[model samples]
Target: MKIYDIPGFPNPLRIRIVLAEKQLASQVEFVKVDLPAAEHKQAAFLKINPTGTVPVLELDDGTRIAECTAITEYLDNLDGDPILTGKTARDKGVIHMMQKRAESELIDPVGIYFHHATAGLGDALREYKHPQWTARAEWGKLQGEKAVAGMRYFDSVLEAQPYVAGDAFSMADITVWAGLLFAHFARIDVPDDCNALRAWKERVDGRASVVNPA
Candidate 1:
């Protein structure tokens, strides 16, 4: 299998962590994509993923998979144990719910704010961002506000449970972790009062996969 991605990027890092967790790093070859150069938006890259995103997985037989969630689901299940996703119906439902929340509430907002409100990835990528929305810095600022609110919400959730979904660490936790990472990059700091979220971050940071991902 081959993974097309830029190393150290938040979305790609999520899958790399999954690979480390599942011990599948050795089984895959990673091809770096120059995100800052807008390589993903080019015609060649678009053929593999019309959405023009990085961290796409290509199976040996030529099947291509896009989106972090979908790639994670495939990698997690490949070993049969499915530790990152979930083994039970209830776990699966909760994990997916929290994963969606992590993206919608946190990561996605940070991305919007980063790309629109700031000079994201420099001039090469500027043309690809929504032309109508590019000048609307105010809207991007609002998204940054939403991301802060998301941090508070996740803090509350963490106060009541060991992980995002529940007791065990799952894909939801990875998404949340990466969301916080993206937030940091976008200069959206977690609130000082969000102790639980801060604590949870420290714990997750110590994990082997997070510290040394694929």
Candidate 2:
């Protein structure tokens, strides 16, 4: 299988981290897209994913899989492994619930505030390039602050558990890790009160798959 990735981007990195966690690194071929060049916007690239996002998986049989969540779920269903996404209905529900919260409350809002207010993808992504919004930096900053509150809530949940969905390190953890890692890169501050989250984050970061993928 072939996977298209962008090293610095959060979406691709999410899958990369999961690939490491699953020990599937060596099993897949990686194709890196030049994000700064806006290569993803080209028609050739769009054929694989109409959305033109990175971390697209192309099976040897010519089937294409895109979106980080879907890709991770696909990996979970394949080969019947450790069941990170969950082997039971209750586990799946919990994992998906946490995933939903992390994505909706933290990930989406933070990215939106950053891109729209800070002109994050202005140079590479044409759609979000509106200088008028940059002038509303304060408003965007407030949105970021709101996002941080959600992070705190998420942190509280993670503090008591080994992973997002309780004791198991599932795709929900991967999703949260990718978002928080990207938020750190984006220069957002993590609250000092979140000791559990901090500790958990370190544990996840220290895994061999995350640190030195095969």
Candidate 3:
């Protein structure tokens, strides 16, 4: 299997964390997709993911999977233990719910702010951006605000629990961590009052799975 992604990008980083957690790093080859060079928009690359996104997984048999959530689902379910996503029906439902919330409330909004309000990946990716990006400065700023709100929401979540989805580290935690990382790149700081969230990140950062990715 091959994982095609640009290193350090938030979405790719999410899957990288998943690979580390699942201990599947050695099972797959990593293929670098040079986003700055606009390689993702090229016809050959688009053949794999018409949406032109990174963090795509291509199986040895030529099966292709895209989207960080879907890729994480595949990786998490590859074995019987099911650590990241969940182990039981209720756990699965809650983890999936929180994961989607993390994406919708935090990750996606920050991405919108980066691609629309900011200069994005410079002129190289301009042709590939959505047409609405041209006139969405105000909307993108709103998204930035929404990202902050999302952070506060998660801060409250952490205040009550050790992790995003109850006691165990799961995909929801990965999504929020990725969102915070993207927030850092986009100059959106976590609020000073959100100490719970800040401490949660500190714990997540110290994990071997995150610090020493294969």
**Model number with the top lDDT:** 1
lDDT of 2 at 160: 76
Query: In candidate 3, how many Å is residue 111 off?
Result: 0.9
Put down candidate 1 lDDT per residue, 49-128, tens digits, no spaces: 99998889999999999999999999999868999888989989989999999999998899889888988888999889
Error of 1 at 19 (Å): 0.2
lDDT of 3 by residue, 1-214 (tens): 9999988999999999999898999998999999988999999999999998999999989999999889998998888778998888999999999999999999999999998899888899876776775468888899999999999999999999999999999999989999999999999999999999999999999988779765
Q: Cα deviation in Å at residue 102, candidate 3?
A: 0.8
Task: Give per-model TM-scores.
Answer: 0.98, 0.88, 0.96
Compared with the true structure, the alpha-carbon lDDT of candidate 1 equals 0.93
Error of 3 at 134 (Å): 5.8
Q: How much does candidate 2 score in TM-score?
A: 0.88
Candidate 2, residues 1-214, lDDT tens digits: the string is 8999877677787788777777788889889887667788889999989886788999989999998778888876777864667888899889889888878877766776776666566576755244565555766677688778877987889767778899888877777777787677667778888887788889988877667643
Count of clashing residue pairs in every prediction: 0, 0, 0
| Reference-based lDDT, each prediction | 0.93, 0.78, 0.92
Clashing pairs in 3: none
Candidate 1 vs candidate 3, TM-score winner: 1
lDDT of 3 at 147: 97
Scored against the true structure, residue 63 in model 3 reaches a CA lDDT of 98
